[model samples]
Target: MSLRTLSRNEVANHNTPEDCWCIIDHCAYDLTGFLDAHPGGCVVLAQSAGKDVTVDFFNLHRAEVLNKYRPQLIVGVLQGEKEEIIPTNLQDLSSVPYAEPLWLRARFCSPYYTQGHRKFQKAVRRFFAENVNPEAREKELDGTYISQKLLNKLAETNILAMRLGPGEHLYSRRLLGGVINGREFDYFHDLILTQEFSRSHTRGFQDGLMGGVCISLTAVKQWLRDDDLRERVMEEVLSGRKKMCLAISEAFAGSDVNGLRTIAQKTPDGQCYIVTGTKKWITNGMFSDYFVTACRTDKGISVLLIPRGHGVETKTIRTAYSTSAGTAYVEFSNVRVPMSHLLGEEDQGAKVIMSNFNHERFVMVCSTARWCIAVVEECLKWCNQRISFKKKLIEQPVLRQKLARMISLAESIQAWLESITLQMCKMDYEEQGKYLSGPIALLKAYSTTSATEVSSIATNIFGGRGLTETGMGRVIEMFNRTNKFDAILGGTEEILADLGVRQVMKVFPKSVL
Candidate 1:
């Protein structure tokens, strides 16, 4: 099936609705059957029938839109014109230096990644680049919840299941459009999901999409008893039927378990518990059906799975990030939940919370590292294209130094992230909880602090455009505005730094260096 070239006159002759055609970037598209399906309606297509719409199309549609609509709609190139647009292929890594991590560069090899990792990485990257990024700006600005259509799309690709960070749920499942077997998924694969998804560059919408589930669900799957209930909840969440979030921080308490005011009391019947508390700055709380919550029990700090009920209420909390995150302040008044919903044991929740934090911090590390890379990419592209004083920004020595620092930080953090993720792949759950906790905390602290520097340098390089929300510097601006999120969330920098030292001291030799 070879493609034939169509003459301008020949294209003009197919202007009728029965045989409509249009030109986009010198390529002829037979959209007669698709006119009715056009989101802007048939009249728009009919009006442009037989005319070159390269400018108009590029103005309204992303460069990738043609690739999305091409297979079925494109007919051929105009007789004497050449195709100017090339579709993005995720399998193809960026040739630009520092644009992608070392493993993605030419002739580079990673001890941790196999062909399976590469395949899954390509699939996930393509999925986000094509599906998520196109709508991210709108959702981020408008503070709209992720659409069900997108959720269904993610479900179809097994993204939701994969985000849970390798477990029995993925043992027998296919992933990333069947590019990789779930049985082969490792921490590297999990790292790929976090890094690639963050490429959307809309932090708030990224969290709203599924960030909560990625963290909260770990506690559920790892600690919850009652096999049937756990299975049911996992199925519902992974299938995009129900939403869940972690509720730990409160207005009065942050980074302090003892400071929490939320409390749950057991009923005399011993079948249920009554929960009363308020959680503030909770990610995805406004839209969650279940809260993987921490509270003070009669014995000690505990965790419970509290379903949304009559006494449960949530109000939106606007942060530096968009409300699309579903960030909320939640109130629970006498909410009754079955004792079976208790995670781990009655008073041993400190361990349960500790177990989840390792992976949570790891996830943050992966995202923050990639975010730094994105900032570097933005600055690099800008410096190359932006002119100052009749010369490109890249020609300036000071600008080069800024780029060098940003790239150095991004690359260093990525190396640390990969090393840590490799350990995660080899270690079992308890082992990771036991040994990796301190390293993860330290890595998170380092990466986030590095990100602050990266963000500052990037904003300086971007100048006024860096502060603006739209246009070329949008990503830099967003990073500058929200990079503090990584520094503050999961655990504050000072707290995590202190925790890392404390954990190290636990194993410190009697005779130290």
Candidate 2:
């Protein structure tokens, strides 16, 4: 199809009863009565009116634009012609099937180390330029970003559809069942798993918009197996869909299995557990479908899949990272969950919770490494382009030294992660069950700390502009949020550090000296 291009002002003035327009892409669609439900404020639709926006829509808004509105609500023409631009030398070859493909793609694409690699580096650069812009890639959450076909399929499966609009609570609920639904799974997986697709689909904002509901939901489904309860929870997730979060944090305890205070007292009728306590700094706490919470039981600490409604109160908490899946201070007032909703067994909640963290930490480390790498690359690109003292910043000896240090740090962490992942891939469930705790803690602590340092150095390199939310500012924001997240989620840095020390001691008690 031929994609038609039009200017913002030109399109704004050409609005007709039969035409609808997308300001950022400058694509038009027919939306005569669609203005009423637009979550981004009608001005967005009115601004684009009847125009085409293929020029540079990303440059017009801040990176948070996608996070502020639902992209699906903004309709556009599918019949427009595709414009051909000069293709870069870099390309994504990972999707191509090969019988004896070289490990080069995986190596270069490794979030930690991509430098000195030709094809992979080039692909990475091209992917960033095309997808990472604020307007096109980063924006407030909007419903328009979701695929209708997938939504329809979900609806057909008895799943209620809640169109996620931007600025709502992120990561409030756990999504279940959709993984088996081919279309829905592929659509959602593309957003969470790939950087290239994420940028094009504005998934960061969606992640921020949905909070971590998708991942949390996936985890819950994996951990819980009751067909009826799972369906009920899935309905809740699909209902509000946009503003939900999972809470794993507790006051006075983190990453320490024995330190939890929230108690689940068993009742006579089918063993009900009354939970009461405060869970601090929970992601998506401000708004969440329900919490897959862990609490102490008579047998041991157990996991309770609790839905949010009555008896659960939350307050939004401010932090170093402003954009979030919606972090919150949560308090459970005698909340109760039936024995049927309990994940695994009593006191065995630790196992369930611990198991989730292993995979979660791995994903976080990969993403954190990717963020750091992206920051370094962005800083380098900026330094090369910006002239300082009659020479480029890249020409400065000190800058080169800093860049080298950052690269080295990233590479070291990357290597450790890769080695561990390889090890994990080979281990059986029994072996993994025993071997994962220490490594997971160590990796989380190491990667997060490294990300913090890399981001700080990258910001210093950028000078004052780095502090603002523009230019390479999004990288700074991502680093800040992700770094803090690394310390809090999965396991806190302090907790992990202590665990690492204890694990070593357990292995060699006599070598304490």
Task: Name the candidate that leads on lDDT.
Answer: 1
On TM-score, the leading prediction is 1
Q: List candidate 2 stretches off by more than 4 Å.
A: 1-211, 225-228, 231-245, 255-257, 480-482, 504-513
Per-model TM values vs. the true structure:
0.84, 0.63
Model 1: ten consecutive residues of lowest lDDT: 55-64
Summarize candidate 1's per-residue lDDT along 16-74 as a digit string, tens digits. Answer: 78888988888889999998998779998888888887766754455556888888988
Q: On a 0 to 1 TM-score scale, where does candidate 2 land against the true structure?
A: 0.63
Global lDDT for candidate 1?
A: 0.88
- How many clashes does the backbone of model 2 have? 49
Q: Please give the RMSD to the true structure for each candidate, in Å.
A: 6.6, 11.7
